[model samples]
Target: MAQQNGMVEKRGAGHWLTHAGLILGVLFIFFPIWLAFVASTVTQPEIARPPMPLLPGGHLWQNYSKALTSGINAPVALMLFNSAVMAIGIAVGKIAISLLSAFAIVYFRFPGRHLFFWLIFLTLMLPVEVRIVPTYEVAANFGMLNSYGGLILPLVASATATFLFRQFFMTVPDELAEAARVDGAQPMRFFVDILLPMSRTNIAALFVILFIYGWNQYLWPLLITTDPSMNTIVMGIKQMFPSGDDLADWPVIMATSILAMIPPVLVVIGMQKLFIRGLVESEK
Candidate 1:
């Protein structure tokens, strides 16, 4: 009885430490965002003042106005549209293609199946950064530059997402699939009716993650789309810097940056449940 009580005490202490660590981690992650929010409302001078105002200032509207109209660059609204297109395109494309591919990998038996899996899996290691110049050259050579295709097409398939979905699919019991098969279900029917329905949480989670990945993209789109009209919110943020006669305003820049974060933030928040479900499923 005494030994069991000692064991219970040890478990209680462990749980406390784990919960405390998680709270600290959450605070650490949110601190930068809180700082950015405070900075977004203050003037440049106020930002660098000897005593910074930790509180938010009242310049939000004025700063946003400056950011919205400062250049040949697309307005924040237009930039949001571009980002939305890219995000939705990549999200839909990656999820659809990867889902079907992962399903095939787990459920279907075919020639070169393992080879095909490895070939796609290899792409995760060879990121776009490694092939940036080659990809750029191909885009330039084919005259696919400066278009939505240039921005979205290269990212339509994600090896990481494919692997993630594949791993998750492998966890689903073959008995469930064989049960479907016995019901005269076709391949498409089994996938859409049985598999995908069961995978709804994971799919929604991956969608949010992929959408955020597209929205936060900076370098590739910047390299490809030279046209000002096609600028994404990220590119527009870059355009808000100091020029020969233009002032470099911190509040405006921060306002734009914070505004740029809204959609992805909302997405992550809304899909928090799905995200947790994916993590739990992956672990299982």
Candidate 2:
């Protein structure tokens, strides 16, 4: 009885230690974001002074309003909208193209199919930076520059997504495909009715990742969008920095940073369940 009580005490102590460690880690990771939020709520002068206040100031509404209505270069509201459009376009376009390509690769057997799959896979080594010059040239020629198409089109062909979808599709039972064919379902009909439902969790997971990827894109948008109105929140934040001896607008910049985080945070929170399930749950 003493030994069992000792063991129970040991386990209880370990549990409390683990909780304490987790709380500390959370505070460590969250401190910077907390500082940013505090800064956003204060005035520029307050932020500029030494020993910045840890608590939020009374200027939350004012700073956020300023950021949303009239940012340094482009309005934050417009920038947020541009980012949303670009992110959604990239995520949806990548998923759609990847699904179709993977479906074709898995379901249809044409000549050099393996060769083609390998070719597509090999393009993963070539990121946007490697091909940026030519991609910019193409976009410029196609009149996609400074447009939503320019922001999304150059980056939408995701080899990673295609590879993931292809691997998933390969795991799907051939019996299902055979059953669909027996039912007189067309190729696309089988894809829409059968495959899409199975791939829902995966699609959710990829959407969260791809959406964040698109939202955080800075270089591509900077290269393509010369118009201030087309600037993403990332670009706007960078543009907010003072280039010369002038003081930076800490409050508004911090507010914009917080605003920039909201969409991705909302997406993750909203799709938390499906995202976790997609990553861990294996149908096969």
Candidate 3:
């Protein structure tokens, strides 16, 4: 009885320790956001003063309104719209291309199948930065610069999404395909009906991931979009800073930062169950 009680006490101690660690981690992660939120609510003068207050002030509406309507490079509203369009375009384009490519690799036994798969896989070895110069030149030559196509097309050529779908398709039961074949179903029909339904969870999860990836993109957007109207929120924030000899408006900047976090946070939160379900399904 005493031994059991000691074990129980030990478990209780460990549980509390785990909770304490989690709390510490949460605080650490949220501290910067909290500070930014606080700063967004305060006035510029208050922010310029050393050791800004921890609590929020009353300037929330004003700062956000100003940032939305009168951002330094362009209106934050316009930037937000551009970001949303780019993110959605990238996610959909990547998913569609990856799904088709993966399906071809898995379902159809074509000539040079292995060679083509290896070629696709080799793209993962190249970083975007390494290819950026040549990519930029290509975009310029193709008259894609300053266009939505330019913002998205170059970044869509990576193999990560293709690899993911290919691996998942491999794990699908071969018997399903056999059954479909016996039923006189065409390959495209089977893919559209059976495989697509099975992959819905994976698609959802990947959408969440790719959406955030596209939304947070900075370097590529910065390189491709010279027009103020085409700037994404991620890159536009830097443009908010004064070019020479003037101070940045901290309240507005912080407000924009907070605004920038909202969409991705909501996406992750809303799709968290689907994301977890997809992850588990994919692993199995």
Candidate 4:
């Protein structure tokens, strides 16, 4: 009886400690968001003062309205539209190209297949920042600058997406292809009918990830788009500050930051099940 009681006491103490650690972690992650939300609702003068208020303020509508309508360089609404287009374009373009490439690599036995696969794999090691100069020059020569095409196309070729699809395709049963061939199905027909449906989970997961990635793209958009009207909300937030010694609009900037996070958050929440399933299945 004494030993059992001692064990119970120890377990209780450990459980409380675990809960305390988890609560601290949650607060650490969420506190910044809470602070930004609070700032967004308060006046600039309130935020400018030291030890800023932690609670919500009364200026929510006013601050958001100002940020949406009278931005420093371009309207926040225009930037939001540009971000939506770019994010969707990147996600869709990457998924389409990755799916096709993966299907070809797995289904077809072309010359230089291994070489091509290795080349695509190599891109995983190289980031966009490393190739930005040459890529920008190519865009400039092609006259793609300041256009949606310029914003979307260059970032669409994702090595990670291609790799994920390739791994997933390899796991698909060879018997499916054989059966399709027996039924007089062309290669494209088999892919369209069979493999595409099999990859739905992966597609959803990649969509959520790629959408967030493209939505948050700052460098490429900033580099390619000289036109204010074509600015993305992620980069446009930086433009909210004046060029020189003027004080930045803390309230509007905070409000814009909150708005910028909404689409990605909704995407993740909406696709949570598929995303989790894909992550688990794709690893196998």
Off by over 4 Å in 2: 1-15, 277-284
TM-scores for all candidates?
Answer: 0.79, 0.90, 0.91, 0.91
lDDT of 1 by residue, 53-172 (tens): 878888877777766766335666677788999999998898899999999988889999999998997887776777899999988888878788888888886787788888888899
Backbone steric clashes in candidate 4, count: 0
RMSD of 2: 3.1
Give the Cα lDDT of each candidate.
0.81, 0.90, 0.89, 0.89
| Superposed model 4: Cα runs more than 4 Å off | 1-10, 276-284
lDDT of 3 by residue, 126-161 (tens): 977788899899999999888899988877775878
* Cα lDDT of model 2 by residue, 238-257, tens digit: 88898999999999999999
Native-to-model Cα distance after best TM-score fit, residue 236 in candidate 1, in Å: 2.7
**Regions more than 4 Å wrong, model 1:** 1-32, 42-53, 66-72, 243-246, 276-284
| Each model's Cα RMSD | 4.3, 3.1, 2.8, 3.1
Residues 1-284 of candidate 4 have per-residue lDDT tens digits of: 56767654556769789889999999999999999999999998998786889999999999999888877688788899999999999999999999999888888999999998999988877888999999999999999999999999999877788889888888888899999999999999999999999998789888877888899999999999999999999998888887899888999999999999899888778888866765565445
- Candidate 2 — what's its lDDT? 0.90
Candidate 4 lDDT at 130 equals 91
Candidate 1 yields a Cα-based lDDT of 0.81
Q: Runs in model 3 with CA error above 4 Å?
A: 1-18, 276-284
Better of 1 and 4 by lDDT: 4
lDDT of 1 at 50: 48
Which of candidates 2 and 4 reaches a greater lDDT?
Answer: 2
